[model samples]
Structure formats: C-alpha cells, structure tokens
Target: MVRVDRGLATTIGGAGVARVGYSGRILEAAADDPASGPCVGDWALVARWTDDRSTLEHLLPRRSCVTRAQSGGTSHAQALAANVTLAAVVVGLDQTPAITKIERLVALAWESGAQPLVLLTKADLAADAAEIAADVLTSAPGAEVMCCSCVDATGLSEVRDRLGDGTMALLGSSGAGKSSLVNALVGADVLATKEIRADGRGRHTSVRRELVVLPGGGCMIDTPGLRGVGLSGGEGIAATFADVDALAAQCRFNDCSHESEPGCAVLAAVEEGTLAVRRLESWRKLQREAAWVARRTDARLRAAELRVWKQRTKGSRGHPKRR
Candidate 1:
C-alpha cells in the first residue's frame, strides 16, 4: 500500500496505482488494531473485481514500520509508514533547530527499525550549516547527518546517492521543506510546495502521506510536517543516545537513574565536560515519556483481558451444559 486514507488504500502494483478498500475480515482486524491496518509503504494482496472497484484482501508482513503514540494523549500507536528502509528526519536551517525535537524524531526513526538520516534542509540560508549539522549529529547518534540546499542544488546528488534503490520516508515538522525535498529528488514539480514565512513558519503543502517512485529507482514517501510526534517506546531512545548508554554501563549501581545518584557515570560525564547537559536532559525526558506510554499500554491490555474473562464467565453461567 502506497497510501491509506479513510477506509481506502492506494496501492501500486504491476497494474499501476489503484484505489482499494478493505475486505470484511481485514476491516475487523483493523477495528481491533489500527496499527495492523495498511499504511503508506505497506505491501498488500488486492482483489480486483473490476477496473473501478477493488478490495484489499490481505496485508503482507512488514519488515519495518514507523509508529508514534497517537496524538490527543491516547496510548494507541498511529502507524506512519510501513516497510520503509530509510527514515529521514528533516529539519530546516531557517530557524534554530530544536535539538530536543530532533532527538525525539531520531528516536522515532530508530524505533521504526530503519536506518535514520538527519537531513538539514535550507542549509543555504544558514551560514553555519556545517556547525549546526555537527551539533545535530551529537543529538542523533547512530544516524547519518547531511546538510542540503534544494534551492542552489547543493548536496542533492549526495542525497540521491544515499537513497539508492530503497524506500526512504521523509519525517519532519511543517515548513521543514519535505515537499521541496521530494520535488528535488523527483527532479520535477510533482508535489505542491509553499514558501516559508519570514518568521520561518511553514504552511502545510503535502496534506497526505504519499509515495512516489524515484527516477533513478527506489521510492520515497513525502509526508506533511509533523509539529510534534510522541515516542511509543525507548528502544529508539537508547539507540539515539548510545553514548549516554555507554556511560550508564559504567555506573556503580546497576539501576542508576542518573538523577542525583552518587557515582553515576552519566552525571560524571556531564561534570567532566564530556556529554552535553542538554543531550542528557533530552534523554531523561524521552525516557520518562516512553515509560509512561508503556505503563498505559499495559494497563489497557490488562483491562481488555479482564473484559474477556468476564464475558466468558457470564456465558458459562447463562448456558449450563448437560451431561
């Protein structure tokens, strides 16, 4: 599936892109777990009844998926994309990069099981593009960092080279130049783009997550700017902060929280000027969030189990079996 909207999915196959809806069984499965539903970049089995109508019969196992804690404070995870090989965290250099947000997004990309790439867009606008990129590299450990300017075409070839014959998904906040990056990669004005305001705020140009096959092979998904994305787990966080994790391994206590704990290697690094205080704080913040989400999900699962038990008990009592 290249794109999913409402109850329909647009899939690309040998027959070309076709609009499809879910079969009854698939709809029930989706109702029970929205994450199981087809998402952009997913592969599916489709049954075509006619040229105008088709049904999504089954979803193939996804090799990778990008998910986030759904917005509006729900513990449910919203699947962003599936089967993505490369996840690019796009951030514009027009304004001061939100290092904290970058850390969060890097975690999201890491959790997706795809290699993360931090693409700094609008690099031409920032004279200290390299310096800013260096700082971002520290925030996003285990991820490649690149500074590109679609305007002057600087670094476009490098970007294309990095995306050789694999699906890459662009993840970023609004006005982060996701659409522009897609146009540059596609080598044409295939997607609509809007200019960022003087204040650096960007309007939504790509309203939906859509996939396009690149000219040189491979595919790319252009997504709307994500203002804020919640982390669903800490696996990505640990990967993003591997340096901090390495320090934590040397801590005196096995369960050192790294707060005010004595002999905490993480804090010691901060004092020794090895680790940035901001980066540590960012790790702590995301850790708390991931823990909270885990607790909420566990509770929800327990409640569901209890409901099933109650229903079974009621049925047994209401319908007595005869010997």
Candidate 2:
C-alpha cells in the first residue's frame, strides 16, 4: 500500500499503481482495530472487480513496522510505515536541535525493527556541525549518524549509499527539510518546499505520508512533521538508552529504580560526571511513559476479553438447550 485514506487505499505492485478499497472482512477488522487494515509500504493482495474497482484482500506479514502511540490519550499504536528497512531521522541545525526529540525519534525507529540513521540537515548554516553531530551520537547509540546540506549537496551520496536500495522512511518535525531532501535525492522538485519563518520553524508542507520511488526502484516514505511523538510500547527504550541499562545491570538491587537507591551504578555514573544528567533524566521520563502506556494497553485487553465473556454468557442464557 502506498497511500491510505478513509476507506480507500492506493497500492503499488507489479500490476501497477491502483486505488483500492478494503474487503468487507478487512473493513470490519479495521473498524475494531485500525492497525489491522492496510498501511503504506504494506505488500497486499488486491482483487479487481471491474476496470475501475478494486479491493484489498489480504495483507502479507510485515517484516518491520514504524509506529507511534496514537495522540489524544488513545492506547493504540499508529503505524507510520510498514516493511521499512531504514528510518532516516532528519534534524535541522539552523536552530538549536532538540536532543530529547532526537532521542524519541531514534527510539521510535529502533522500536520499528529498522536501522536508524540520523541526518543532521543544514550543515552549511552551522559551522560546528561536526561537534553537534558528535553530541547527537551520544544520544543515539547503535544508529548511524551523518551531517548533510542540500545547498552544497554535501553527504547526499553517502546518504543514498547508506540506504542501499532498501525501503526507508523520513521522520522529523516541521521545517526539518525532509521534503527538500527528497527533492535533492530525486533530482527534481517532486515534492513541494517552503521557506522557514524568521523564528526558524518550518511550515507544514507535506500534509500526508506518501512513498516516493527513488532512482534505483528503492522506496522512501516522506512523513509529515510530527508534533506529538508519543511512543508505543517496545524494547526501543532499552535500545536507545543502552548506556543506562548497562549501568543498571551492575546496581546493587536487580530492580533498582536508579532514584537515590543505595549502590546504584547509574547514580554513581551521574555523580562522577560520566553520564549527562539530562540523558539520564530523559531515560527516566521515557521509561515512565512506556510503563503508563503498557498499563493502559493491558487494561484495554482485559476489558475486551470481559466483553466477549459477557456476550457468550448472555447468549447461553438466552437459549436453553433441550435434551
């Protein structure tokens, strides 16, 4: 699936790109759980009823998926891109880069089961781009980091080579130059571009998530600027904060909370200046959010099960068996 709207989807396959809708069963499933339906980058089987009509029949299992917790206090995971091999997290250096935001996106990418690549944009504008890149590297462990500029066309080739004919997804906030990066990669104005305001914030240019085919038949999904990136439950936290986890392993207690605990290795590192207090705090914040999300998800599952049990009991009481 390349695009998904209300009840319709567009698919790109060997047959070609065509718009399609969901089958009745699939629609029903989606109504209950949105993630059950088709998403962009999903390989699916489509059936054609007429020259102008088609329906998505079955969705193949996704090898990897990039998802985030749904906004507005929902306990559901919103799939950003499916079957993605690489997630390129774009950050602009025109202004002060938000390290916390970078950590969040890197965690999201790692949670997707895809390799995360951090691209610091606007390198030409920042003289200390390399220094900033080094700082970001500390936050994003196990992920490749690069500094690129679209103006002088620096590091674009390296980015392409890093992608290497695999499906990649662009993740960033507004004005991060994600669309501009896409245009440079495709060598044309394939996607729209806008100028940033005096305050250095970007306008919302790309309104939706769409997949653009790269030069060598590789796929890239360009996502709109994410304002509220709530994390879905996964081991991404551990992966992103591996440094913290490693210290926790050596704590006096196996379940050390790292908050004033006696003989806590994490606290020791913080006091010794080996670890940035900011990064440790970020880890604690994300861990709390993940725990809250897990509790909500478990509650939802239990409620669903109770509903089914009640329905079965009501049905059994409605009709007495005659022997």
Best by lDDT: 1
Candidate 1 overall Cα lDDT vs. reference? 0.89
lDDT of 2: 0.88
* Worst 10-residue lDDT window, candidate 1: 314-323
Question: Which whole-number lDDT from 0 to 100 does residue 176 have in model 1?
Answer: 89
Pairs with steric clashes in candidate 1:
1-42
Q: Estimate every model's Cα lDDT from 0 to 1.
A: 0.89, 0.88
Candidate 1 wrongly placed segments (more than 4 Å): 50-52, 317-323
Kindly list the per-residue Cα lDDT of model 2 for residues 27-56, writing each as its tens digit. Answer: 887767777678888999999885678999
